[model samples]
Target: MPHPNFILLYVDNPQQSAKFYAPLLDKQPMESSPGFVMFALDSGMMLGLWSKHTVEPAAPKIPLGGSGELAFAVADAAAVKALYAEWQQRGLQILQQPVSMDFGFTFTAVDPDGHRLRVFAPYDPAL
Candidate 1:
């Protein structure tokens, strides 16, 4: 049986996307070619950034608008807040500031291409 693997996103500019994503991901790409770069996340999931102009004809097109909102389970609310501030300082568009929710503390931000990312940490009842 074939195992499920990486999810690749098409980007008009791979280098710029890589720069924006590297810090958020907390790691640099393990392998990078002219058309692609892949970062291995802590969850063992691989995120790939592929050059839109160079990808194969069969490569799936990323949906326009906010169809996909990637949620990451972070360590704590403080970490989430720090990342939110960092991304904002970098001039990235923030959709929401960190807030307590039923499930956790969360925030949202949009990448260079308007891809939405929701970062969150489990809510602590004591806090």
Candidate 2:
């Protein structure tokens, strides 16, 4: 069984991308280079930032979920709101305000590369 545990995002600038991501991920890159940086996420997933112009043989079509929206799961509604407020203060481009939906309270923000990062919590009717 093949397990996918890594995600790669091609950015125009790797260093800048790492800087933008560090605070959000609450961690720093485990490895870095002039053209690449790798972040070891707490969820046991690895995120790599690579220069779009320098990938070997060039990268095939990038999969960004219809608009580069990356959904990040949160602990709950409060966590979602806290993140929304935090990212809002950081001045990232906010695409949507936090609101209740089929999933739960959630919001969307845009990264430096125009990637839509969504934070969502699972809905539960029970208190």
Measured by TM-score, the strongest candidate is 2
Error of 2 at 84 (Å): 0.8
Specify the highest-lDDT model's number: 2
lDDT of 1 at 69: 72
Task: Give per-residue lDDT, candidate 1, residue 30.
Answer: 94
lDDT of 1 at 56: 84
The residue-by-residue lDDT of candidate 2 on 24-59, one tens digit each, is 999989999999999998889999988888988797
Per-model TM against the reference: 0.79, 0.88
Q: Give the residue spans of candidate 2 off by over 4 A.
A: 60-66, 125-127
How many clashes in each structure? 0, 0
